[model samples]
Target: MKYSTVLSLTAVITGYVLADTPATCSTTGDNTPIKSGCCPRDPSKRLRRSAREIFARTDSPTCPTPKFYGDSCCTHEFAKPTLDKGTFNLQCGANGVADIVNDAVKVEIVGCDTADDLTKETCILQISSTPAGSITDTHLEISTSAWTSTKYPTKDPASWSYTSYCVKTTGVCQVPLNKIGDGASALCDKKLYIAYHTSTSDGTTSKTCTGDGTLIPGQPGSRWWEYLTLDFTCPKTCDGWCCCEKPVTPPPPPPSTQVCNIGTAFGYADGAKNLNGNPVGPAVCDTANRWGWYFATSETSLSGTLIVGAGGNDLTKGTTVGTWSATITGSDITFKYDLYDDNTNGHFDLSSVHVYASCTAPTTCAPGKFTFKDDTLTGSSDTSYTKTFSVSGGTCSTYYLIFHASVNQQIPSTGTCPTPAQ
Candidate 1:
């Protein structure tokens, strides 16, 4: 948006009269009254003409005044008819008064004479609200957005000597409804003043009138033709710069769907038990790389299917083949399982290694899906192993775990696996 310097209008002359009493003189002679110029009787009314058009038509030395407002053709040499109340309307959208309160409406003033080239000049348009008999007045500034070049009084359409400006109230403009009247009601029924002025325009050299177009009484360079006063009434409610009622706000969004807490231990379900008779547990010994008995604790209940790759076969194929149990607390989970070796005639290496969980059944534990895995027990007869998982979430429920094992599984010195209930 562009902002320019503003020129203020002063010494406002209020009250509006469309035309003078009809002249009874003839149309062809110089006997026409000097104040009310000569005109043909019964002149047609021209509604909503621009100020420039009204000035030019009334000053024309013709029988029929083209843009006169009433039957009498009053020459505007002394006074030009100011814009009436219906000439301009405030365009508050379909919401009407509600739009004004919300500051969603813009007041546009078009066809305002700027008197000079826009690129070399600055123009100002102002609107003020004053009560009928009150001295308080509030002025609002409007910014110019467009310009047109045209002749003012000449009938030739090709002439471009004078500049006209188009302006509108902007987004940053707000109506102070509380400052207008008594500040207790919703209706802003007050006298409105609309004025337009250019920073460098001279009033005396621009037009041929004395009353509305002449210089203001005390202001040396100010013009009276630049202002139009009328009645302004609307429904609005505001306290200071804010509307009395607030605008409606929109609603918020929904929650997320992730199920895993990524840094805590995965716990066991209620009533989980270990079947092996080693003893209730947390039996500690050397790590799996040394020669010693280490009883893995059976704390967590296995709720999902366990796929064990024992002796080059899936030991999880039958429910009667093996029994497994596990429990987790804090950052550690201990598990142990016992599986019968099907190859009884020949000795085979127990190479069982990794454990994993998934939402569905799988033939092999994939790379990214391994929940608990250890490579130290491969090709060995170690009975106990321990590893830690880093994922955090609710306890295991409605899922499957894949466990790989080998033949001739070594048991702890006491038993194959520990029973946590014992």
Candidate 2:
């Protein structure tokens, strides 16, 4: 009995020590290797394991059999991915006076499918939304991927252009929803359609629907969920910038008026006039009230002048013209020229002096005969003489002004030389 008890105690102690031994990698777990240990530690010595692994442990694509070196892992491999995706429609409307654009639905995705799986490969879920028909507007802009309406008489959205925002391969993701605080990243208006795609580890899967209307060129994956237009509050009317609400109608514009500007102008006078009704006083100082100025337009075929302005003064300080203006309002034109000199009424007769002028565009000037303003004679400020005339313009876009003064000179025609005393 004593020998048996001693043997039992030794056996119990041996069994406890064996049970407490440091663990060695086995083919069952992460069948891997270590440099050296109490016994041999080699993956080759491990038993084969059939643990058919998928997007295992890390949710990352891993080899069906992962081997760890005392660590239980080595080798890079891609595991199959299972995708779950959702899509939605575009929603838009008005809140009081402001407008709102919304995603009726969005691309719903649970990219990493397995529990405790972080190693699942990354992929993209693209959703595209577009209108069903063509629309034209002089007040707003609309396209396959964009639409906007502002105001008119400003920048008409008619000419605004854009390219489609498609063909994206982005991988970032979230379980986004268009809830209270959540909003859509894109918008679609009018008769609309939507579609989506879920890419896999190696390539892309088929389409998974989230909204229903008409899915154009539908893409298919072995797995998908379609959310077609179930129930919706279709807009009653379109607004100026929106496809819903009462459409804003623009009023008709008013008629335009005719207008023109001055091109060039001038005036001059050169001839002798009698003073005190007598040609004897210094032979009627040779000169006119206004002369030597030209008014010409840019054209010759037209009859109306370009309302020219002119000013002139003699180098000898004998005469000066201040404030000369020629203007045309509607079909009536008026020319006013003021002459100043020390010889106010000094060498000019009271009656016969007449001013004749005409304006022709492009080439010549027509003649218009008229008398000076009888009310504009003044002895103040060195003989001030002001004359104004009104003329008609025929349909010419351009005109020229030509004038001259030639008081009965020498009379080489009918009058005798030095006046015949007979």
What overall lDDT goes with each candidate model? 0.28, 0.25
TM-score of 2: 0.18
What lDDT tens digits, residue by residue, belong to model 1 across residues 1-422? 11211222221222233323333343334444331222222234234333322211322222223333222332332211122232222212223233122211223222222212111212122232211122111223211111212312122211311112222222122233233233212222333332322211132332111101111122223322222233333321110110011123557653322211111111122332221212454312122111111122233444322222221121232222243455454444555654333445211233344555433333332323356655444443343444555322334333344444433333334443322110
Model 1, which residues run further than 4 Å from truth? 1-300, 303-322, 330-332, 339-349, 357-364, 386-388, 392-400, 406-422
State the weakest 10-residue window (summed lDDT) of model 2.
4-13
Per-model TM against the reference: 0.19, 0.18
Give the per-residue lDDT of model 2 (tens digit) for 1-422.
00100000000001111112223322322442322221122334323323332111122121121122222121223231221223333322112112112332333222322222223322222234432212111111112221112321113222322112223233122312121011121211211112222221222322221223222222233222221221111111101010001224578763332111111222443221221113233211133222233444433221211112222223242222222344544334455443322234222111111333334321211122322224232223322223445433543354444432211111223433332110
lDDT for model 1 comes to 0.28
Using TM-score as the measure, which candidate wins? Answer: 1
